[model samples]
Target: MKYIFATFLLLNTFHLFGQESAPINHELSFQFDNDLLFFDAGDRYYTNGLFFTYRQKIKEDRSWSNLFGFQSLHKSIFHVAFVSKIFNPYNLKGEKAEEIDRPYAGELYVDGLYTSYWGQNRLAVGVDLGWLGTKTRSDDIQTNLHTTFGWVRPRGWRDYQIHDTPIAHLYTGLSREIVSIGPLSLISDVDVRVGTINTNAAAAITMRLGRSQPLDASVLTHARTGERIANDRKCKELFFVTKTQLMHVFYDATIEGNIIGEPSPFVKSAEPWVWMQSVGVMLSMKTFDLQALWSFLGREVVGGRPHKYGTLVIAKRF
Candidate 1:
């Protein structure tokens, strides 16, 4: 952990500096997450994730755009992504399914998002469609990953895995800048979700320092990226960011199993509220954008402990 943090500092220090807001015509990104990146962090709940996204500035005339708040924007981007998430019990050494601390679950889905920018605010809404349980193929993916990396293979997935079921969910969030001074800014956000997979509401605040841009024209906010028109020339960004969010979780199917279907062999009641923290750095140069962040999540299960994970993202704009 110290080494990683040191390396991040060195990279940021190397610039001591660096450097957003014509909308990129199109953008593509790949992001992945794993707890192993955080040294000494255990392999447990919310263990790994994989995502691929493609985004484009909204250009076509759509009748419902106004109905969905897409037409009220100074600018808007529409994106679609394929995402997968893997979860495991706290202890993989359990001899029996009943001995595990949390349920073993996997989620595979595709989601589409519509985000709009206006003044100091951004609004986003999206829907997810996919499957839960063994159908997500997470056990095989994890087993192969562990074997290839020479790590401990998971135990008893067949015995304790969540049952397969279809998933549908809708979510929306709004973000606004609370304060900004040169290279520093504070932002607030509120988000809500309701669906078969998860039902929750959350609030978060993010602080960033270093090279900065207007909230509507910032890469950190994911409002703009790639070759954006900044001073009518090339644009660059390098910043350190930290965020904290609290969620009121009403239902989590991954841990509680499909509420509308047959129950899994082992399921635990989800905690009512959860906390999450993210600390990282983002750098965007010309056509490429890169980010590295670590996420700490409060326990989702009643008796479970918190967990930490790392995420890496690479994006391209055209």
Candidate 2:
């Protein structure tokens, strides 16, 4: 952890001192998802969680121009995130609770990405390094469990846990706008990941409605541009967005079924695939953006119930 911090600081220093033309952007955001808000019918796949992220972007030209000074050579992004996850109601109460609950876990990770663009299409490669373990307090876990299940007995110190391990994941993604009709646009994206502990692939299609014009080329390709520089667009805009995705999981090292000596014995076998659909609205202005999305997920595990979750994101850019 100390080394990671040191590296981050060093990189930031290089960014700050390198060149005058280099531009940087940063965003702070929070996201939360819970099953209780789904109105009691939804359950498995994922339960409830909170995630906080800090992201920094450096423009490609500037990065490449300052490469001799330890600057990046491609459009680069760095992210730091904190995550917390809580178990579902059924996992908290059944006779097999101790073996299946998983209770809760806390994780912290740092991610780095390098991206390149061709017209409106983008290609990105990234890696995530983190630590995941059963560090969340049992009392807090019980409180959330009670909130979701109501009047459930606390499980005491008996809980399931994944053995602490450093996580390393590498991935690549491609995204592009496929079509446009007036103020509406269609976009597609696909991503694949392989890690020391997990492997998954996903593809998604999305539609955006109500923009006066298509997103700027830089924004479309997630690159830095004069629009981000001038920062003159204080006028707010509203849009409705919808997305559908298909995902497949080949393995998960954190789940008990895939790792030896894992204390959380919830799943005896891995579920290979899942599907998700979401609808949302986005509001964006000069320096602020907010989005609210409702999502439905298909069954991820055999006999597991399909579920619904909501995500709210608020971001401030600088």
Candidate 3:
């Protein structure tokens, strides 16, 4: 933690040198999805997710860039994130077996995304590559964290984890704003992912009110622009948003286990459909942007309990 603080101070020293329209912006963000923020029991299916992300602009013209013709787009960016997701069953103290509501599993992966934008719309493609099961070290990370914090020791994860296996996933997303009314507007989004780790499709609609930049280059929607010197805008924004989402599942290795290799000792049926509701707010200053969101979800597996998680994001612009 101290090392991170030192690095932050070092970067702040470059604020002046970072003044120009270099046609690039860098953001480091940390996201935590956990039910504890809502003061719930906090342990069970879709238990917790932690991610670290770094994003920056990509140049418009490189031999490789020629493939995308990025100059025609409003903005282009490349971002990478390290993700850790843990899944727990209804009973953490029970003996490991198929009798549980869900299997014990963990995923540790690195994902990269490329995104391009046009007015009020954006397209994104991404890939996730890494390991699933015991190799992800979820039990170790969780145990150490819990012990240090005096939280309950996750004893059952070790006995119940799925066998180690490799994973790969490909995904794409598109979003567009279909209506606008001064401070209020509506946006629609659709996304899909397919691979060894997870296969699913989702559609969402969001209504936002208050102040914001256009969708083509607004940080609120993660459509950040690399084409302008951020300070040049001098816009301070605050906005409130609400969203509804529905998803259909095709496969979920986290619960079903990988289809091949040494099969896990246990697996379960993924729910065919799930619903989600979210409410959030975004606040932006020249130095940083802050977002806070809370989400409630219908069960992801048969007979599973409903769940909720909170997200907080702080992004620096440089």
Please give, for residues 118-200, the per-residue lDDT of candidate 1 as tens digits.
77888888999999998778889888878888777888688888888888999899999999998899999999999987999
Q: Rank the candidates by lDDT, best first.
A: 1, 3, 2
**Per-model tally of clashing residue pairs:** 2, 0, 0
After superposition, candidate 2 runs with Cα above 4 Å error: 1-24, 36-45, 64-77, 87-91, 97-106, 116-118, 136-159, 212-226, 229-237, 254-266
lDDT accuracy of residue 131 in candidate 3: 91
Model 3 lDDT tens row, 221-271: 665536455554464678899999999999988777777578887777889
**What's the residue-level lDDT of 224 in candidate 1?**
64
lDDT of 1: 0.80
Residue range with the least summed lDDT across 10 consecutive positions in model 2: 217-226
What local lDDT score does residue 293 receive in model 2, on the 0 to 100 scale? Answer: 82
Q: What stretches of model 3 exceed 4 Å from their correct place? A: 1-24, 63-72, 96-99, 225-227, 230-235
lDDT of candidate 3 vs native? 0.77
